[model samples]
Target: MIGVDTNVLVRYLAQDDEAQSPVASKIIDGFTPDAPGFISQVALVETVWVLTRSYKMTRDAVADTIETLLRARELVVEGAESGYLALASYRATKADFSDALIAHGGRLAGCRETVTFDKGAASAAGMRLLGAD
Candidate 1:
């Protein structure tokens, strides 16, 4: 299986990048049923972060992107269901409550553990630091 990174996904989603979108589309299309493409949990997280922060996608747009990603035939990840639920919950909460809702959704989706760089999120149930640092 071929592994895709956040940049690839961003290029696929953000067609505004004239130089990269076509290439991204070609790469995505090349992955037929015989040859599947995969993406890691870290890639998914980074994709969302980039879409929201750099591309200025709204919460709804992010959710839509994630839903499209989940529907793809070849994508792979560890906690896809949990991540989807977390995104949904993130959309519903007030700014201050978003992390709490994400944590709750993570638990509800049967996540054995969640990893985040945010200290507050790390303290939430079922969450752990992405690294010891």
Candidate 2:
């Protein structure tokens, strides 16, 4: 079972990047009854974030993306509750809670380190901020 990453779903939904769309399409299409695709909870949450923020998709569009993924039956998720709650709180906090949840969830999941882009989150407690790129 191949693990689907957030970028794959984002590219499939966005369809704006010509170079990667065919690859994304093929990957998604492979999730047939015989050959199913798989995705993690983190990918699901990140996909929503990318769809809304990066692609400028509306809430309805984001919902449609999620619906399509759910219908695929190929996607598998872990920590569904954590992902949902993290996304919800992140959205509610206007992105402020994203890193916090990521850090907290990572710790709960027994990760050694939680990497993030938010400086505030890095300073909070257990998160490590990535260098500016």
Using Cα atoms with residue i matched to residue i, what is each candidate's TM-score against the true structure? 0.68, 0.57
Model 2 earns a TM-score of: 0.57
lDDT of 2 at 89: 49
Error of 1 at 36 (Å): 2.0
How many clashes show up in model 2? 0
lDDT of 1 by residue, 40-92 (tens): 76777788789888989887887788777766776665466656666665566
State the C-alpha lDDT per candidate: 0.70, 0.67
For candidate 1, give the lDDT of residue 82.
58
- Over 4 Å off, model 2: 79-133
- List candidate 1 segments past 4 Å from native: 94-133
- Poorest 10 consecutive residues by lDDT, candidate 2: 89-98
| Candidate of highest lDDT | 1
